[model samples]
Target chain A: MADVAPNKLRLLKGAVQDNVDLVRGIRTPGLGRRKLLESPPPDPVQRKRIRRLWLWSPLSLVVIAYLLLPSPVVSLRQTAPIKTFEAEIKQTPATAEVKVPETEPQAPASEPHALDRGVIPLAIKKIVIDAGHGGKQPGAISESGVSEKEITLDIALRLRRLLGKTPFEVIMTRQGDQTISLDKRVAFANTNKADLFVSIHVNWTEPREIRPLETYFVGPSDDPVTIKLASMENQESGYSLSEYRRVLEKIYIDTRRDESRSLAKNIQAELYHSLKTINPELDDRGVKMAPFLVLVGTEMPAILVEVSTLSNEEEVQLLTNPDYREKIALALVRGIRSYASNHNGVDRKGS
Target chain B: MEETNETFCVGIDLGTSRSSISASNGERHVIDSYVGWPVDMVARKVIKKTVLVGREALDNRLMLDLRRPLERGLIKEGAKKDEDAVQEILRHLISLIGLKQKSKNRAKLRAVVGVPAEAFRNSKQRLRSALEGVADSVMLVSEPFAVAYGLEALLHALIIDIGAGTADFCVMQGRYPTEEDQRTLPNAGDSIDEQLLKLMREHHPEAQTSIHMIREWKEKWSFVGEPKKPVVVTVPVKGKATDFDITKEMGEACESILPPVCETMLDLLARVEPEYQENVRNNIILAGGTSLITGLSDAVQKALADLGGGRATVVKDPVFAGSDGGLALARDASSSDWEKLSL
Candidate 1:
């Protein structure tokens, strides 16, 4: 019984060795079935001991058979159909009895180059200036009788002239005093691929006394005060076009909102600095957000400037001066230039 | 300047009679729109806090000097006596609205508040600054526009918001309304209450009536034109039961509130284009608590008909309609770029 126990142990060892050989042979690179057979068994004495246990101990034989048989079958079951065909070779009598040696392969020593060569350049090519109101819509009438349409147009034209020397191509949503719809203004920017959009107007107040310089951005996701101003400016141009409406919806979903915000901040900063420098008493009114129909559907970064309160007597008087208009235009141009210089690598993709 | 995706937006409806706040992340709450202060040392000793706000302040009328922030639906900014009361009320109201929530930090707060349509420019700014202290962003829209946005009627619709102090009218033209589209009239539920108080004093000299009692009577039996049954009430005059006739007085008082409402609606109707005129007429929606008056719709419709020819309608749910509309606008506006709205 003691001899039988040692023989059983030898037989189990042999079976385990055979399983390892078969797994290694199948996994070994470039080795075929014939090559596996060319290798000799580890020892003759061990083989005899395993053979003796198989002949004498029936219980050991049954146990060894029970463990060894299922492993190959389980491995075969687990492997994919293509691998199963390769695994079948290990179950063959001659292949199942041998041990196979594993080999290590060395990798070659050359460094690979990057797929992308260098950084890409993003340049502002075109800008769209949208004068908020035109034609039939006179917009807010100042105490001094300055119309919102006239102020916006004056500012827009000045901005266009300031950008004339720059690389940026300038486009005006409305060149003359003609009524242009909000949708049309947005469409012009989208079609032309305008990098930046600026709509200009003047602020108004009830009791015709309050005066301030405010800027607006569109809302839904934009700030409320800005949206109100934009809405107020857009109200002056009442014409609504369905074609631009679709484009506007698309622009709203685009990822340019963040960039638009950055542009707004820069413009607000520039405007605030310039306006404060000119008149310390002038209310900074700061920057606000709103859902302005004109700004809403534009693909580019957009801002609407309420230069000064047309309702205020002093402000309206100043607004009529070419110097004041020039100062506002110069301040806006400076703001746009600063924004463009800082965000040179960002893709504005304006027409 | 801090833009975070997790920023929360808040919509607050600071009504003349009551204030409610709703959050973009789904929270809606209301607080009484009143502030109170202890009148004397005895009252101050009874209540440890120097001030009280909302329902508690309103209920404790005798010991506290109650003050409403708004008069005739506009903030009484420079009023001398109610300074402390207003500030305390605002602080309490802001705290209750959870202005200190974690969302206040990570969330970009865009607060849309409803003010009277005809609010002065300076008054709007003062109100904006007041709200801005508690919010990251503040947007002041007329009360009627908020109601219009609440109802999703941005185009070809008229909003008639009848609150305690004023009736605000606005015409929606497929966009956020401009100043031209809005009008406010300083005649509403409070006006009716005042009329009732005056009429009762004239008719029943011995009958006792306070503004509160008159307001309660107006809330209970206020109607224009006629009611199915006449209203009779017993008054406590010098702690004695006194029967009074309030039917004619209530009807007359309620009727007096209509002229301004009709006149504003007519003005709003005339401002819109002739083509959209019929649509605006058909889509006239009445909102606010005062609009809950029994025969208001029919009477207002009759009034409109008398002006020219058109239809007028009241919203099915007046109480939550304006706030709900503001909430809807906030939800729709959650993904909007805040910078695009600044002007």
Candidate 2:
């Protein structure tokens, strides 16, 4: 071994005759047996390691898949853009066992970080603002003859101005008094990869005295009251009530329902707190579950806010005031910030 | 009006703590009145059902919206999102009685559901709505009255039926015990359980104790006058199971209701016809699941001794007393006794 040349390396360090024999590490002898037959074969331990790896590789692949892939590929692909709740969650330090992939779209760096202590910037980019009941569809009319569409649009624009100060990308379903189809509104949000979906609407019931500030997340309407609200919002939509359960079933796998509910609760709380002074009688109905077509069709954390019933005189007067509308807008901005504050970039690949 | 095989009569003690239903078909069931609905689709799939009743409901409550629809022995009034749960419990009990739909004439169900003493008319109306589709004809009767009816102590016995919810006291005066003859207090087994739960939680903040655990502890180690022995049990604190001594707290919670019951018992005795007051005081019947608490009868009798001589007696079957009485009433009730549905 010491006599070997500097540039030379060999499996067997004895005198070699032909170049082919040296390269192959085998030499022919006149004993009628192979020349290197007497030499040591490959070490049993090293050979066994290679053999074991080959034997266990397939099983390891199955185990890895079982541990990581919690959902189907088709569902992920369909909801890839807007459904980032689980994907974002996977990025947390608690989930060290699963590794998130890098190729997924990242949150914008300019956006305000979540308030969650030491959380990474949640990639909240585009947000869709849907002012309910536009054009021919006059949402709800107040006792004083104020249209719900006007109130919603006014508040939505004000919200746009408030959010404009931040790095977020806000998209309005309709910039003016125009009718955009339900499919088109949700499609616009999905197309833009909106992180959050907020649809603004006013509530209505018989006798016009019901005054409540409630937020709704997409679910099977739990009661007749919820069904009535869903029906009122889902009037023009082509979908039927029969399909509501299916929509809820699909949402359960998407992980958006939980986020949507949290968003609703946050927004509902802020709205009640801000407006409680303007209308002392304003009732905080809290978060509710309903199958509104606008929410069910969306693939994002969506909530429909029944800001205040137009039937109540106090609330109707409150909605009519520009200062009150601005307060409502500011409250909504605060809620969105709170909900998105803890959202951070998480690697959701194989989740 | 005569006894007929076409109709099935069921007597039910629809209590907040426990519910019991006894049918004419000789089937009987008593279950913890806990109902829960799965929280989401994943839970529904994993649980393999939408609604769960009784102990199963409590065991899988994490993934459910657990609804205890009754409070103070009446269907919880003003409690939102409880209608479905109330109906589910009613339907489950009726099913346990085997209301075979395929049978001829559909076996018209005429149920007499025993309720808390002096239950609100609104509560009975709510209960009536809940029982609409389940039973063709139904009647709501005071719980203690039902117990008195079954025991045939309808003459002059004072019934103090202590249950998980309200403590019902009724004066059986030969005729039906009217609302004026009964008193319902919102203090009983459940209230004690709650008090104990609060004490346990406060005493050992790190202990993982729920209402169920507190209830179990109360049932096994409850004593009024004295502990007699150390009332200690192992409870999971933080993560490790550790021995916990709750003798003082358990004793206090169990004894909290005694004063009210004693006062009510004295008041009812005073109100009784002066002639029958002696008999009523002597024959005071302490009947109900909560009456099983050791020394409770003696505690009552001791308290009652202040207002002349009195003796408190325990029932042979506290659990079935109310239902058995309700069954007796249902079988004896005339056609006019049942509430006729408009349909």
Report the lDDT tens digits of candidate 1 across residue range B58-155. 88878998888776555664565554554455556556656564443455566556777755444554564454445555555577877876666767
Q: lDDT per residue, candidate 2, A1-351, as tens digits? A: 344222221211111111122123232221111122112333898457435544543443333233233445324434443234335434543223111123321222222222332333346777889888765676787644567877887788778767876888887886545545564576677877888999999888656676877898864432566666666676545332333334433432444666687788779878888888867777777777666767877888899998878777677766655557878999999899877764542312212
lDDT of 1 by residue, A93-153 (tens): 3222111112211111111211121133556778888876765666887643467777777
True contacts kept of 2: 0.00
Interface Cα RMSD per model, in Å? 38.2, 50.4
**lDDT, candidates in the order shown:** 0.63, 0.70
Most lDDT-accurate candidate: 2
In each prediction, how many residue pairs overlap at the backbone (N, C-alpha, C within less than 3 A)?
46, 2
Tens-digit lDDT track for model 2 on B85-196?
Answer: 7788888888888887545678678777888775533456678778878887766667887788778886788999999988999897765454346777767898899888
Q: Which ten residues in a row are the worst by lDDT in model 2 chain A?
A: A9-18
**Number of the predicted model whose DockQ against the real structure is largest:** 1
